[model samples]
Target: MPNLYFCIPKNDAVYFDEHEVTHMKVMRIKEGEIIDATDGNGGKYKVIVKEIGKNEAHGNVLNYEFVAPTDGRLVLFAPSGRWERLRWTIEKAVELGVDEIYVFNNEHASRHYDDKQEKLELIVREASKQCVRYHFPSIRSIEFLDIFSIAPESTYILDFKGRKIPKRISKSVGIIAGPEGGFSKKEIKLLKERFKSVCLGKKILRFETAVILSTGIFAMKLGKI
Candidate 1:
């Protein structure tokens, strides 16, 4: 098999027209040479060069394969930590392959990020390309409890207040962590009523540590990793 290059269209033989032909011919690739291509849609294609002309090159289509982009679950991450930790969490979350991320700016939240979503998105993009993944996770702007209430089901809040860590994985999960000062009593109560609060054992964890650990453990339980 030849080296691979990612392009827009996927799962078909590529006809190297003009520019591409010049590129390949200049590189001295011969007829019948195999090449690989990806469509950035979780699919890969292998093709064999059939003809190489001055201005164009045609290929014989070969087999194709795909890896599903969307994992079975939708994940919601409520931002509640410090800068260094939150940034680290975002990177790890992208590496772990969370579907969606939301940074919640609670009334009592400690850290306020000016461009948290943008920073995290850059991290996800780099991680995605490094992993050769066609799709990258989505990160939304900072929000509050009022915004979170309407989110999809299967929500989980990673709080130390609850008993026992979560063990089972479902179709979707939303994890909420508090700030350094922790959530206000009212915030805790409201979240408990709206979303299930999950404990991460006896030891109290820093906001950033908790965020990364919670998502990592959740994926492990779901067998996604």
Candidate 2:
């Protein structure tokens, strides 16, 4: 089996930059070796390695293909938290096939997420390659609490206090996972009006874990898992 690698674009061409070039040379992938390439947005191309150099590699395009992107109907609302957990959530959520992951500042969040946007993007890239997923999940900057008002989709809140358990999704879904200490009463009330309050279960779950598990359940319900 060919060892697969992922590449992000620096430009639109057959050539890949320094980092991927190093991998190609180190792995001894010679000219004419069949390699698969993905553009990380549902695009996959089959190419033949034509030239290898110290800092770059060029491939001859053989064929191209793409998977229809998972629609943007599902949006994950991840409350800000520790870097490790945040990265883990992003990776797992991508692998699980969430359409979008939205990190947001919350009342009980312990850490700040202003920085590290680049690092998170890298994690998503690696995770996509590792899981052999064609479409890269969208990761965006942290939004504010009031931002919820702008979304007109069916928002599902993963809280124990939720009155409804989601069984099916007919339209776009906005899933909100609260911070470590959970959402405040005021915040919960604010969200309740914007989203249909739903519970994952009777038991409590950690921030990252809740996002993944609840997403999985929703996916299964929607027949997307």
Candidate 3:
């Protein structure tokens, strides 16, 4: 994949951040070279390096276009206890075309841990570049209750009783994955009330594994991926 660059929108031009410029310096990029850049809001541009400084980069937009997101928004809800696990799931989901990721604390989830929000953000940014995608996935932590309030076209919970997905889902959908200890009775009861409880298979799987496989399967069934 080509190295994807990012810049902030400024009228007709774009400017790179300190970290992004430093990365280009480390990569030994030179002026007058053409590169692909994204605004992280659907605009992808073909730019020519106009200038490179110690802490910034200036590029001239040669051409640009907006990229429509694939199919529809796919939101993944996962446990927020372990940063590594959360980051892994977030990265894979972003690469596989997830639009947003919501990490929330639940009844069975570990409540004692660092925020690690920076690490999660960095992971999604890097994954977007690596996958050569123009759309950026929004990543944030939320209360477990806020998740259920989202009005998606379809709602699915990762649980034991889920069978093969019956039909292709073509609208906005939410996938909820539980923590290592699984959901509490109240959580399960709530899930049953609001969404279809779905599963990957008979065999047990890790939280990280469950995320990517479920995303890929659903994306495919939706005639995407």
Q: What does the lDDT read for residue 179 in candidate 3?
A: 83
TM-score of each: 0.66, 0.84, 0.90
**Candidate 1 overall lDDT versus native:** 0.65
- Tens-digit lDDT track for model 2 on 1-225? 245556544434467667667667768788889888777777787878877778888786677777786544667777778778888888888777777777888777787666878777777777877787788777776755645753537777787777656556666777887777777788878887777777766776666667777887776665455
Model 3, C-alpha of 50: deviation from truth (Å): 2.3
lDDT string for model 3 (134-193, tens) is 888888777778787863758788876787655777578888888888888997888788
- Which model, 1 or 3, shows the larger TM-score? 3
Indicate the worst ten consecutive residues by lDDT in candidate 2: 1-10
The residue pairs in collision within model 2 are: none
Query: Which candidate leads in TM-score?
Result: 3
What alpha-carbon RMSD in Å does predicted model 1 have with respect to the real structure?
6.9
Runs off by more than 4 Å, candidate 1: 1-65, 110-117, 146-150
Best by lDDT: 3
Cα-lDDT of candidate 3:
0.79
